[model samples]
Target chain A: MKQRTRFSRTVVGGAALSLMLSLSGCGAGSDAADGDTIHVLVYGDAANKVEKELVATFNETSKVKAVLDTIPGADYQAKLQTIINSKQAPDVFFNWGGGSIKPFVDAGLLLPLDPFIAKDPGLKAKFLPSVFNSAVVDGTSYGIPMRGTQPVLLFNNGKVLKDAGVEPPETWGDLLAAVEALKADGVTPIALGGGDRWPTLMWFEYLYDRIAGPELFRKALDGDREAWASPDSRKALGKIKELVDAGAFGTNYDSVKFTDQGSPTLLATGKAAFELMGSWEYSTQQDAHPDFAKSDLGYSAFPSVEGGKGDRANLVGNTNNFYSVLKKTKHPQAVAEFLKLMYSDQFVKAQLGIGNLPTTTNTERFLDTAASPEFAKFQYDMVKAAPAFQLSWDQAYPQSAATPMYQALQQFFNGSMDEDAFIEAMRALPAS
Target chain B: MTRTATPSAADGTFDKADSPGIGAGRPGFLWAAPAAVFFALFAIVPLIMVAVLSFARWDGLSSPEFAGLDNWKLLFDDPVMIKSLWLSVLLTVLGVLVQTPLSILLGVWAAGHQRNRAVLSAIYFVPMLLSVAAVSVLWRAVLDPNFGVPAQATWLFGDGNLFGTQAGAIGVLVFVSTWQFTPLHTLIYQGAARAVPQVLYQAAQIDGAGTVRQFVHITLPQLRNSIITSMILMVVGGLTTFDTVLILTQGGPGSDTTISAYYMYQKAFKSFDYGSASAIALLLVLVSTLISLIVVRLSGYDKMRSTMEGL
Candidate 1:
């Protein structure tokens, strides 16, 4: 009996040791006590340069080493998702401020910023209410909006318009007339890339918001009301169809890749007359074509429908694209401090100098009037307008509903399906 | 005769005390312990987990609930899933039927010609050397209507765009896939064909058989195993093909080119419907397994193996 007991004890001890070793191996903690290193994940070339400058400044002042991993805007989400799923999420990473962050939040991945915000008086007052509200979910803020983008009509050169003998459109009718005039001049009226489903959906969402207004759009997206039967939705769909029918897009638009189509090569070469794109295109076009002048570029809000309820200046976008600290991170306090440094006056000045729109309300004061005249005018117009800001429809909707809707819109624009069919298909999407 | 020898006695003296511990009983369990533990950890455990999860609803992160047959039912009812499964089958059949014969012919052509065979084989195998992403991107550009070689050629000939219609897109996809995969099959078939005896061809020639007739009679029969093996591999690969279609069309023009694997990916990652995705995955596994079994039987591999052993 004594011998048997000793053997059993030995076996039990072996099992215990193995279990302990396995558990320890599974949850090995990183030794980051040096306090000299900081990691940041940022998006876009412009943002990357600005981040590097800020990090350099921080390193010099604080005697710490800062590293920034910059991912492209298109690939950032997928890469971030991989990191999060691997449970090796970065210390600081880019996060969109609305339902886009909900997946991470639901996964218990993001650090709530309420305590940090309460401690920092500068952050509390500096952020706009709309921008700050985008970060809140279930009464907890998960991200700090670093930059905001409002949807604006990006047009080609004034020379092209003058050659076509058309004015910048102020109303829906004028927009149609401009397209016709450009078409007559042997120019592709609109440089739309329907190949990427998302870009095509932008037109749909813009028209939908303009027709139905924010409240109804929100209600429809939330599944509280039906969107398919709405006359406003129908009219919006019809407008997209009309655009398609008007030879606004290039031949073989469906087969064209978005990168090839959206690139400034065609527009710069004068193959296409106009492109309804976002404000980011300004920097992109300038980079692509060295000869492109800021004076040659034109920016405006989407023209208002003649009898529509939505106003011309009803901005459809969000203060998305920001960074949030991971809840699973070891150094929460350090991460919050990094975020504070990122949004400081010096960082804001650097960002604005690089022509990026900062989310902080006070950041506008740092803008140099002499440096960027276009950005200065945009800032003034933004404040004076008091425009109704609507969230991006695809961004606001659940991914299940959103992806198919975007795809359907692409199909509709490709002339494979009609507006009514597209709306019906969207309505028929499975709710989960 | 055994009684006369008494084998144990002839060898040495037998001890009754050691008899119980000797090779009289079943083998020790320790021999199988490692294998059991490995299988339990790697295969059995995960399979059990997947099977359990398949019957329940979970979003990969959240708590699971008993879903019963809801997911499986959704699998049948979902039109996109059904269409994708049909497309996958079509791709498999097409890949096997078209690529196998072409590979065999190339393999036969290059087997005996030693002088230029090295250069020829290298040229044929170039496509297989490329990564899937690289191949997809290369083909996408080649098939691109606005900026591709094909489009430019079509324009020169006054035929318009090559990727404008559904048939054109599918044609390019099929052509690219076959071009990329035929090289791998050719190498496999060539190695097997080379192993066949030259004596057999001489015998066929003595019987007044020409090159084509000898190939049909002796060469094909000898290479039946290799052809079947390559066919099976190609079929399996075709059923799960995703990268080329994704890079080229992204299931655009209303999900025209969406296959089973891409459909599952879109559901699980894009749509965040893990339960439905899991259901589709389970169904795919069952279908693939059944098809593999049928193919093995139809290829007469078991009969061929028995015949070879008898010879």
Candidate 2:
């Protein structure tokens, strides 16, 4: 018995030792190869496909190899946080260039790219000012502009509007008229997904920004201005109440899951007249309802509010989703080289072909100037017009404050709290 | 070194010396040394670390600040945390109250002269076999407002939105949890019921006792230990329910079904507030421990053990 026990113990110990040695060997091997590879982490299914193709293209031409790690949108933050905490952050990772990256930048986890930008005169001149400015923190650029997405008024087919005998709304009064027309025809005018707080907040933001103007919006977020007491903010709240009173949104909107709800489909099928959604909705709408072409879609900013300084062109957007390099990258030069490749003409064309809005100076050249005449017109107008661009409210504030702000907005939309309560809650948000 | 040699008897057997080493034997401590070391390293060390972290303020990135009782104090003031804890307790109590008796009944029914017992058990146990993610996705589709089974049912029978209210959502969650867990407890109870002596049943039959009487008197008493074991398991499992709730509601429509475990995850991972998360975890552990002790004592496990030993 003793002999058998000793033998078994020796066998177990030997197995453990071998396992440890193998683990150590794998670690060492990875460390040795880390010099050659530029690990990039990104989020979203669409971004994953694009990134994979980009990486493959880069590997074919460049001396350094590129690896793309695609994390799910929901899990990306947690995964990135873990990697950062472990000091095993990837060479390049997706970042929301505003306050989301502020924490990482402040911790010195991100590599500042002003020095790189200064050396590359082509890159310095090619990037959009808004995109470049979004990445700059305390006079240093820490991220590269990837894509830009902004909210636009998306409307359904001619059936709903034709039945209502109303043209596309260009002003707040026109919109109200359209809503009234739709109500007369016994059709829901606006299809809003209050279940997803973000969508509800988007409408709130558009109204609030239009009412309060860009300066007050920024001031309110910074706590320099109180939203609860502001008459403009209250007016914005009243607009939401107006929509609710008009029965613009569906019944039991609070309980519906955002992804499962068929608001996009409703628009495609002409069940709903219009939807206020981000530009990404184009892709999702096309995917869900293939019959609905890009031509069928009309793009407009939120209708101009009466007696408000905000115009139709005063857009609310941010170059929030961008990419940055980690300071601890073994191959910073290689990573930078890869990033340069991403900004190349071929990559830009590929990104643009997929309907992504590139933040480069060459955006106009790649856009569907012929196919999407309305979008082309909007782009041209934007270039000629110098309307103030406001950053997304959630992205502008620190995450600690921003998360609860979203929850509060959700609560407000769900009818648990009024607009005054929401503004007060926003006022009470802790400073980061 | 007072060495003394004891003389043997006339039988020629040498007398062994009763030295301290011989009396005690070479200390038995060495035999238990490895296991103790391993237990201390793996279990005790981690527990100590968690306990220490519970008192400190951390963001899971920078070095943790020693905030004394700040995290614990915050727990009392945090409405979300308190609500989540209450929700978890409510879920646990409801799961036990509904599931335990239902599982026992199913176990008893399956153990009777039922020919399709194996097939029925297999069908019932399928949900338990599925991954939580798979189950959640399947249920999400079934509960979808536009095209799901529940929605379809509601449209056919009653209202069009079965999951449109907080109470309805919670009911669906509870139902799903109970359905998934009942099979496991049923199987456990069935096995225990199978182990009860056939002679007891025969003796009851000879006494003119009916089938119901046999079950109530003979079978139930025999399966008491199993029932207690399964109930404890169910309570513990229910207390930490997260994945299904996360996939379904994400503590939605105003934090309706936000259990303590989900709250902990949202704080520690989503919001990166590790300090409060750790405190919540510590509180969860304490509550679970207290409930478990009370349950075990009330179930008369010790008495059962003594009786079994006496038998």
Candidate 3:
């Protein structure tokens, strides 16, 4: 009985010790914020250099010191999701505005920025309306556009296109013709990073927008299952099938990835004619294949679908990265002051210098200061003129929908799932 | 980090309990209190939390709500969940089949006292030193369709499209894990082979047995203890294969290689369905534990007889 008592006592003590340990672990976040510093969490990348500079600039005059906390690489979103509601949640954090922040807003963890925008009209007026509106959750402002917009473009290797005697395609028919030419010339018609499933999603986004005028996708996202089964959706899928059967991306695209420089290398090496990628492809090319970027990198809007309901000017990609504040933050004034830097002249110049297309109205004046002024002008004009800018399907849909959506898209593209199967899969996704 | 380390949680407890312990010098429960507390803290506590979470509905952002058997019911109804479990079993079976013979042959070969064999053995041990992440990344770069070794050896790799097909992707995964992990098993077999009585080999030689017969008759029976240990490790390792799938294939061309562990990660991080993910995790823990137990029971390893006895 004495031994039993000792064992039970030890267990209680150990449980207490472990409970204390875990409690301390949970408390580590509150310790990080303390009284003076506002933790500014951002995705760690080359762009962080600019974010770091802005944080330093914020600290110069504000009574509250802004401490930059960065979570790097592919795990950024996962890390953010885990910590967003915890005591460790930052005062302000970076996000891709759209379905990305909807859950946070739904949970009431995000501070609506209407009050901030009310105090300073520039918070809303300083940025492009299209980019600004992406972060609006159910008609309430939740994000400030911090980084530039990344509208997807059809990037072509000039040398390969010329060798195939094809131009940068401006219409669906021309693109098909270019694919035939490039294939005949012994190059992959278009390099696709299908291994990274999100890149494969780009085709659907643009095609759906062009064929169904974005209304079908909007309806589908709003929980209308009929939207996916509609003729427009089937037509979009048919077009994708025709392109695949034509061997436009070759037979081995699933073996290639954009993130690992596989598809980009094919374009740079004159082995592939075209790659539909975001505006950041410019900087990516500049960094990895400067010679090719200088001499032959050409980009155009996704080709217009013939007789499509959507305007030719419709764009799809990441609209912009946003700075969203936590509702529980004590430093709303400091965070507001920090968000103001997003539209500042210094921020625009820094972003442009790094080849980012800032969406600020002041962004135009700094276009000449861009790393590639020609590229910058193209993206800016396209964005300014676009009737609709659809976010990537993976980003626009709630996070829960991403896995099955990716599976369906990949299977359909790879011949594992037929049109109806793909439609059913899309219909089954949990609507936001 | 959670991928390869998860099943080891169950494996570790059993492994320690199985290790020989007895007599006067044996530490009391008081001496083990610290380690037990640590185990409770890191392993048992978290496992209980996961078990509790498995029956709840959580998206990580919102607070968890009791969902009764909903997550389990949902898992049972999910075709992908069923497929993922099959994939995990297939990969594990393939790992055991491909790795066992190769490691045994290499192990026995290196057990010989040739000086050159020492150098070769050191070289063979290189993969054992690499983390699963590093190994997966290295192989991913090497197997890249357009730019990697597959491109350089087009005749061998056939357009370098190994990741495009189900068979090809599974082949690469099995081959890579075999390459990265066989060395450790080889080292185990080597140690066990060395412990086999030299007298048995001498007697076999006197009976005009060749090297092959000596290995089959003498070395095989002697290495039974090590075989069970190595096989258990392999079983657990294969069941929880996450990083390699994440890095190399991401369970694609279309859920073709979606092992349960990787699927659990997808449910948790990608889908934000922590409840379902926890359910999947618990299922994995159960599967790995059951498989390990079966291996022990069938192999009679739980009896813990001395291979060194009857000298």
Best candidate (score: DockQ): 3
For model 3, what is the error of residue B161's alpha carbon versus the real structure, in angstroms, after optimal superposition?
1.2
Positional deviation of A398 in candidate 2, in angstroms? 2.7
User: Which DockQ-derived CAPRI band holds candidate 1?
Assistant: acceptable
DockQ of 1: 0.26
**Worst lDDT 10-window in candidate 2 chain B:** B1-10
What ranking emerges by lDDT with the best candidate at the front?
3, 2, 1
Which runs of model 3 end up more than 4 angstroms from their true locations?
Answer: A1-33, B1-25, B308-310
Which lDDT tens digits does candidate 2 get at residues B73-159?
A: 988887778898888988888888889889999987877667887888779888889888788777776765545564457645244
Poorest lDDT segment (10 consecutive residues) of candidate 3 chain A: A25-34
lDDT of 2: 0.71
TM-score of chain B of 3: 0.91
lDDT of 3 by residue, B70-93 (tens): 999999999999999999999999
lDDT (10s digit) by residue, model 2, range A1-432: 355359557755765676677679768734444567888888866646667778898899778788887788878877887777564567888877777777787677888887777777655567766556666777788878665444344445666687778887777889888888887777768766655656777787778767877777767655664655688878888887787777776554554444764567666767578887766666676677656745465555678788876766666655436788888787777777777865677766666666666667776676763234456446435633536656667776656665567777777765777877787788877643
- lDDT computed for candidate 1: 0.69
Task: Please give me the DockQ of candidate 2 compared with the native complex.
Answer: 0.22
Off by over 4 Å in 2: A1-30, A33-39, A48-72, A85-87, A121-124, A148-152, A155-158, A176-188, A294-299, A317-320, A327-343, A369-386, B1-43, B155-164, B206-211, B305-311
Give the distance in Å from residue B291's predicted Cα in candidate 1 to where it truly belongs.
Answer: 1.4
- Please write out the lDDT profile of model 1 over residues B230-258, one tens digit for every residue: 87788778877888777776775567677
Evaluate all candidate structures by whole-model CA lDDT and list the values in order: 0.69, 0.71, 0.89
